[model samples]
Target: MNIGTAATQTGLPVKTIRYYEEIGLVTPDRRANGYRDFSEACVEQLRLLAQARHLGFSLEECRRLLSLSADEGRASRDVRALAQQNLEAVREKIASLSALEAQLQRLIAQCHGDDAPDCAILDDLMGQRGN
Candidate 1:
């Protein structure tokens, strides 16, 4: 089928599908008119990519996962290692976001949200207070 058909089947945008093909993620055949001709296997791969992306897998990580997924007897140890790495990343993101949230809360609490020319929010941002 065409790219549109494949997009409908996989629920992915046509641009994303083209990007996947360009990045060697999926190699769909090209017709004489130069239109992309997708196979069922390629569409299935696209569906897998969409699912992996939804789970927050990076493109390179997804590529590695795709490689591992192809192996029927893939080592569990490898999968475990990747999962651990992703866990660490998620933990770090949570820490950074928490810190940002605290700072924002402090800033907002100090802000005068009223209609005043002398805004506390601007003052705080300009390093007038908070030593």
Candidate 2:
């Protein structure tokens, strides 16, 4: 099929398929006088890349995983380890965000939005704004 057809089959954009070719991810054939001629295997490879990317794998990581597609004894332990590390990072972010939310809520409560122009929130936000 053509490059456009391959893109449609793989659910990737035409530009993305072109970029994959440029990055040595997929190597489709060239027709006489030079048009990209994609094969079924290329479509499958693009689909695999899409799925890997959707699962948060970077391009280099996707390449590594693709290389393992041929390996019968592909050790998935490394993938699991990466996933665990990412989960821990996410949990840390949640904790940090929770603390930030608490601090913001306290500041908001301290801010008495009345006519008297003595703003505690502004003082906390800009330490230069003298209390």
Cα TM-score per model: 0.86, 0.63
Model 2 is weakest, by summed lDDT over 10 consecutive residues, at 78-87
For candidate 2, what is the lDDT? Answer: 0.81
- The number of the candidate with the highest TM-score is 1
The Cα local distance difference test for each model comes to 0.86, 0.81
lDDT of 1 by residue, 1-131 (tens): 99999999999999999898889898999999998999887888898899988867789987987788778889988877777787898899999999989988888887778877886767778998763
Best by lDDT: 1
lDDT (10s digit) by residue, model 2, range 4-121 = 8898888899999899899988899999969999877778888989987776667887776667764778778866765676567668879999999998898888889999999888
Cα deviation of 121, candidate 1, in Å: 1.9
In candidate 1, which residue pairs get closer than 3 Å at backbone N, Cα or C atoms, i.e. clash?
none
Q: Please give the lDDT score at residue 77 for candidate 1.
A: 88
User: How many clashes does each candidate structure show, in the order listed?
Assistant: 0, 0
